[model samples]
Target: MTKFVVVEGRTLKQAMKIISAIVERYNTIPILSHAKITHRAEGLRITGTDLDIEAHIDLDVVDGGGGDWSVCIGVQALAGIARAAGVMDVRIERADNAMEARISVGDGAAFYELQILPEDDFPEIGGKQGDLIEMFTNGMLTATLDKVSGSISTEETRYYLNGVCWHITKQDRRFVATDGHRLSLCTYTPEGGEPASRIIPRKTVKIISNHLANQNLKIYDVDTGKLDIVAPGITIRTKLIDGTYPDYSRVLPSRHDFTLDLKRDEIIAAIDQATATGGQRGAAIKFSNQNGRAVIERRSGDFGNAKVKTSTPWPAGKVEPQPFAFNSRYLRDVAAGCQGAIEMRMTEPGAPFSIFDEDKTMTRVLMPMRA
Candidate 1:
């Protein structure tokens, strides 16, 4: 029962690129490095996973003959072969119940072979996807993630912040991520779904963002701490992070008496210019009203000091804002995705404040550095 998968080299190459996102870079398990190529009546499906997430993409068939059996081949190696194959047809075949598999490229012009792992050995994250719990367009999903993912913490100690917390209620759909110092939250409207929540890992959010640019429709299956996304001929299933998201709303400031509206570009440019001389840890950014004009300043030991002026108008009768220092690293995180006029609001120099656009669909809260 020799099973085979024949697809165009270009198509295989494209599919491998998507599967590549799920392949774990550091894996001790031999089978984890290989992609399980399964032959079906419809076409060839290539699958890869890193235990936490499983991704698969289907390719158009060129020519193949055999029963539906799967063979695991090294993912990166196969991708390299596909890239070299060019416009040729890629033919992959294995003998029935055999360990060795052969890859035919360019009609016998070049051949590559490797000992394959059994399909049963390739682990898959499974879930019962009965319905599309939530339906969102590519742009919507990308916008939501981009607006919030920057705040996703990389610290392993507080594992809860290592991913974006998605909460779906009968009335609202929101995505929130925080790295302790700063927090970002975005709200969006989806087609429909039952009340559910999931902490999608940062790795999986990255994969979704990469594919969202080209995908038209994105389907989500969030149930029992699992998330399965189906898009076109691609499917990605990932285990949700098992942790309780902190009540972030409590820390978010409700109102700020002082406010400054600065253009999005100026905010980003100020952070970029100021943080250039900072060290690996973080740098302090100082903001204050200099003679009724808004000013940003950053001082580094050897690099000297940098300053930027913004068009934010100060209230004529209000008390001038005292010099306040904020971590440039946190500002950079939220400033990366901000758009339009960013309203900087705070009750005082030491209190937590928020920055957001006019519509307020997304908001970022940052705590200022102590004096």
Candidate 2:
């Protein structure tokens, strides 16, 4: 029989961090990436895995037993317990070749001998860290990535477009992400670290977003190409996806000749009204240049159709009436992102168009569908 003792609070946090990293990417198999807990004189070591994603946590709490014993437990249940448990002592024991956790939190005590899977079944994910750059802030990287990742494709077929693309300029410090539908690019100048670019997988981005929680983080070198993100008491190292992103500069309009300045709310209201008339699900927006005013029309198969005219229309120019139909949802997404006036640029009816703020700091592009 093997027994181990450790502080429940800090150890719980560390274990949860490792478990969460695997669980977020966990699949149908419960035992696939379950954590293995081992107790010795030093402390507790928790290991978790999901084939491609693997994590381990080492706790520094006092260890009572000089002997060693390893037991596998359900990480999901363990996480639930840790979230509710408080500062106390955790006594891990083995009885009848089974593992149990005798947990004490505050004035309450609970004993649970959870059925576990074989530790050998857990797959190992080879994680290597390359040259690492130190990140001192939290919200800056997390928030910027969050904004850009919004446009990432959820489709599995297009594997490359599924995550945020990290681009390091040869001279400037800028990061860019695009999903072929919408794009977000931002720049940051740091005092230190060499310029590097790598595509961060969607799962890793999500894990970082959930854990950062408005706290600062540290980036440490793991091996050669992989980096470990250390935040508070949690540490996660992820392998970067490799691919070549498309040239985004070509999509942007060199000269957006026609411009319309209208209240963000007003355009959103127009979209809503048009969408409602299209049907319950949604519809498309057809922009027609009728003389000076830009006529907006909505079409629906189940229901009927509706058209709404904008008050402050496009300025009179030599450009003739250009008609383009875009998914209503795509238009609304960009409109909701911007405040004040909405700027639209168009070169062709089916060609992609861009809607963004005047500052040009944050831009969203949408491709028009044939109506």
Which is the leading candidate under TM-score? 1
Query: Candidate 2 on 170-287: residue-level lDDT in tens?
Result: 5655556676766766555533235566677788777667666576877666664456777654557676665666778888776665666667888888888777744554366787
Candidate 1 structure quality by residue, lDDT tens digits, 187-250: 7764334776679999989988887565655566655777777778888888889989998889
Query: Could you say which candidate leads in lDDT?
Result: 1
What's the lDDT for all of these models?
Answer: 0.81, 0.66
Give the Cα-based TM-score of candidate 1 against the true structure: 0.92
Each prediction's TM-score versus the true structure: 0.92, 0.81
Distance from true position, residue 305, model 1, in Å? 3.4
lDDT of 1 at 304: 80
